[model samples]
Target: MSVTQADIDSAATTLSTVIRRTPMIASRVLSERIGCEVWLKCENLQRTGSFKPRGAYNRISRLSDEERARGVVAASAGNHAQGVAWSASSLGIASRVYMPRGAALPKIAATKAYGAEVILEGSTVDEALVSARAFADETGAVLIHPFDHPHIVAGQATVGLEILEQMPDVDAIVVPLGGGGLLAGIAAAVKARRPDVTVVGVQAAQAAAWPQSLADGHPVAAASMNTMADGIAVARPGDVPFAHISELVDSVVTVSEESLSTALLLMLERAKLIVEPAGAAAVAAVTAGAVDLSGNVCVVVSGGNIDPLLLSHVTTHGLTAAGRFLTVTATVSDRPGGLIALLELLRDLGASVVDVVHSRVADDLYLDEVQVTVSVETRGPEHQRELRRSLSDAGFLRD
Candidate 1:
């Protein structure tokens, strides 16, 4: 079950018709921040909106005619299910996918839309996987594992092949780690071809199992914390993938939810790209000072299927983090001219108000003063500070 360059080449050829040759995009803004030639591998633009199709198609394409007739079953949070369903549909095989109940709605809809029987089960991917395996045993369908199979690993290696082909002299490649299909595949190809290039894996800090498990010499999940990167929220890395990771991966890094959301929002706004939290983990890691990035480093953006509601929140979160948006309270005299003066001050600083909360009864405000809670958007921290200075100069006291 060893992955090789031949496996990658085969995967690339097989997936040519099924999957996209995801773009290798360079980001000057990110490059300057990380002091590296930052290139973003846009798997977010791939079929099924993620790199999962690469592995899924590779595994399904190898099925025997008898196996195809028998059909395929898989368990996933969302991406793997969509990948399997998409691949199976193309091969005219009946596909059944099990997903955790809390999986994203968009992923669930997309997978079902791809012509698969979607089954919601359990509270976690691990639990759904158990159910999927049982269902496969009962139905005589092939169980297509998300990341623990050789075919899947070989398929994911196609991403690495594409990276090297796109940027032959890339100094490092950063990938988000889940069960490690992407990392194992990329490591296999990159190490087999150019061992000198570093291959690093990034994980959500809230789900940093690999590094902690490696530190303990065994798999041990981290404490639970909310993260936007659900695609990488694996409780543990696959044993097979961990072996390759141990030997081939240069290092594993973890980035916080704040960092991931910030990066995701940056991709959407500045880079003019939409990236899901898991897909943005590599960039998040770079922003969080994970990689020793200083040369040409390529970050794999693995997916872009974020829900619209969540996207709205992430955008605000990012703006707040970068100091482009500020929230503060000001107390002005309870007179019409007082509020107008504050508005004039904001206008002078070129700040736009986003929200306002008013209270006349708060003890924080004098009987003759009104407390106004303001959320304003500015250019950056400097602009925000300048705006605050304007308020001070205008004789409006900030609370």
Candidate 2:
């Protein structure tokens, strides 16, 4: 069933006291970079660290007394799990959540802390969803889908309503797409009120399904799903959101893993905001030039529930992708000052050494030669190329 503007209005009223009206902050860095006035819809700072609660609370509040007595079941990698659990607990309903085995520990802990009976099952959200569906079937618990129901869509559309009120002159709205609920819902609400505004959806290139599905005029499963943006690594689009997305969303684009990491890093460093890879997808498209957006553009920073370890890894990856980090292996004479001489050379070349590993024993190394691997920080691509040339000129680089 299609969600309407009135449905979104009703959802806004339902969530008026239940959810936080997240702030919309102007992004100077992004505006200068994208050659447009950019505003960030900071749902990352919302309750449960995401916009999921807006939908989750709205959906659960509408459940019949008998359905509420039956409890609720949901499956998610992270954000949605916390949303459902927190919402259910607030409404005095029991909740059971199924999550992938490899789901972030912090998310699992947060889910349990919100009073959900957490179950670890399978290796992906889709697999966990299978378990959740079976549990719902056998236990008579009401199943709360991540993004496939009209209530959920309507609730998520409240975000769109807020954006319109916050930025009446907004020319475009960019949303991170997974199962398409947020994108579709926002598009429906914004388009219904401001038909002149453009709505775009961004997805991780490694796990994108919307582009192909839109082309085929139906939901098509992705052949493979592997990305650091686990939150949006949906294998397929939900039928409910697909219908609205096809009609309301102006365009859908994909951003690379490098772009995702880079955008996350930018948000953390420049905006002083912590956002997960999936949450950074919209900004990734803007920064990577994946979408041609102009005028007053609002990019939704969907969620900030990221593991610390994953954040560290993605930061390093982002630095490397941005040409700020360089790693190289070279052959140096196996002498006492051999490693020191290499370090001195790097220092002279204005490269800050971050890590070093030296070994003399190697299958291809000569008895008098040592393999030295070094990771250093550089200014940019030009500095990296200059460092490589200097190393090669010193006869330290091997073929």
Considering every candidate listed, which one attains the maximal lDDT?
Answer: 2
Question: In candidate 1, which residue pairs clash?
Answer: none
Against the hidden reference, what TM-scores do the models get?
0.91, 0.99
lDDT of 1 at 263: 92
- Residue 111 in model 1: lDDT: 95
lDDT of each residue in 189-277, candidate 1, tens digit only: 88988999999999988787888778887567666646678888888777767777888999998887778888988898878998888
Model 2: how far residue 58 lies from native, Å: 0.9
**10 residues in a row with least lDDT, candidate 1:** 218-227
User: Per-residue alpha-carbon lDDT of model 2 for 64-172, expressed as tens digits?
Assistant: 9999999999999999999999999999999999999999999999999999999999999999999999999999999999999999999999999999999999999
- Give one clash count per candidate, in the order shown: 0, 0
